[model samples]
Target: MNRTLIITGKGKVSATPDIVYIRFPILVNDVHYATAVKGLDGIVASLRNCITTNGINKNELKTSDFRVNTQTKWNDNTKEYEFSKFEAHHDLLLQLPFDTELINNTTNDIVKLERNIEFQISFGVKDSTIYKQLLIENAISDAKKSAAIIAHASDIKLKEILNINYSFSEITFRSDLNYSYDSCLMETNEKIMPDLNPDAIDVNESITITWRIEN
Candidate 1:
């Protein structure tokens, strides 16, 4: 029977985020379907203009979950459900460079475009492939060192690497947009800046190495 030793080592690399992701939505509601659709179109147009004026790339803007649906409310007085209104949602995602001033400026400008807009912010590294490779290498080195120490203590020789398994874990940043806002138009002068103190994101890699033990 062949004897083998298995060791698991973890390595982490801390790096500053080079990209910032900002996500928000414009919600429109009206008693009439046509009115709601028209309002949504106007709001989207205003938002696009705001993005462009801020010098943000058009390709960075993405719209999702654009839907129009009916809402029903319970009418206690009439003892029946009544069609309240049509609700439409336009979800927008923006990817920009990790400049604090630019993010704050763009966010402030975009918020001025509509009152029904709500948002969440997150930070991330634009290119993580290089960092990922470095972390894995460090993990492998750690595993080999550990195995060598254990073998030396046990008076055994490590012949060769039989197998290696590795995995990576990263942190995700997000906030749920479930707050209530007054249904009114936002004034252009009112600035909305959220405190965005981004810390170094840690990229962790864990590796398990199997080595054959020889006498």
Candidate 2:
């Protein structure tokens, strides 16, 4: 039988996020289907204008999902679900470079749309491939050093790399903020800046390597 040794190496890379992802959800409810959809369209138009004013390109704002569903309410008197209204949901996603001022400005403007807009903000890096490569480098170096130390201590020689295996894991830096204003429009002249500061995102990777040993 061939003698072999296996080692699992782990690595992590942490850095400040360079990109910001904003998700806007617009929900409109009306008894009439057509009215609900029309309301959604008008609300979307207002939303587009608000973000564009903050220097965000119209093209960057993409619709992730749009659907209309019939909502029903349970009635105790009828002992059955009653037709309530049609609900229209529009989910939009936008990616932009990380900027505290931009986040503050856009959110403040969204409130002025006079519609209840529930939005979320998250952080990410633009170049994921670069980060992954650096992560792999670190993992491989760690594995080699570990193998060398084991070989020296055991008085065994590492002949060759028998096998190398690596797998990718999602490196998510979710500083997601889910917030919404009351149905009432924000009526104020002074800007209400939120206290927002995100910590560095840590991306981790791991790999396993097998080395043939000679004794």
Candidate 3:
């Protein structure tokens, strides 16, 4: 029989979000389909103009969804169905480089549209490839430190690494506990509620390693 020992270690590193994502939905409704489509086109044009004037790169702005729907209404007195109206809906997603001032200015400008809008904001690392590389290095360093500590306690030297396993914990954005706002206001504002506390986001990773012992 052979005797073996297993050790586990954890590492965490975090940095302020260097990128931002904004999602907004625009809705246009009218009695006639053509009118609704025209209204939607005008709104989209206005939004594009606002974004370009404010220095937001045109390539970063994109349409996420476009949909059209019709509604029917029932007349109680006549006991008949009546065609209500048709509406066009569009969802726009904007990817912005990390610039706090730009974000604030753009959001403020867009709010002037005053159309039916809903918004959501998220933050992330600017270069995901680099961030992932750093995470892996930290995990390995932590695993080595743990192994050394165990070897010292056991009064033995580590011979070789038998196996290494790594996993990353969930990564999530932190927001205010209870804060809600309409899309119009959200798009036009640069600062977000909860104030973006860096500590709130904790990036954790676990490493499980098996090391051979020198007898």
- Evaluate all candidate structures by whole-model CA lDDT and list the values in order: 0.76, 0.81, 0.70
What is model 1's C-alpha RMSD? 3.8
Output the worst ten-in-a-row residue range by lDDT, candidate 3: 172-181
Question: Lowest lDDT 10-mer window, candidate 1?
Answer: 174-183
RMSD value for candidate 2:
2.4
lDDT of 3: 0.70
TM-score versus the correct structure, for each prediction:
0.81, 0.88, 0.70
Per residue, candidate 3 scores C-alpha lDDT tens digits across 1-215 of 44556777776666666667777777888899989988888877887788898987766779999988998899999999888999789888887875767776776677655554456666666555555566677877888898788889888888778888875655453322222347645544444433432333346677788888865
Q: Give the residue spans of candidate 2 off by over 4 A.
A: 170-190
Candidate 2 lDDT over residue span 1-215, tens digit each:
77999999887887677888878878888999999999988888888888889998888889999999999999999899999999999899888887888888987787656666667777787877776778888999999999999999999999889899996757665544433444344564435456766787787788899999998
Instruction: Quote model 2's TM-score.
Output: 0.88
Q: Which candidate leads in TM-score?
A: 2
Better by TM-score, candidate 3 or 2: 2
Model 2 — which ten-residue stretch has the worst lDDT? Answer: 176-185
Ranking by lDDT: 2, 1, 3
The numbered model that scores best in lDDT is 2
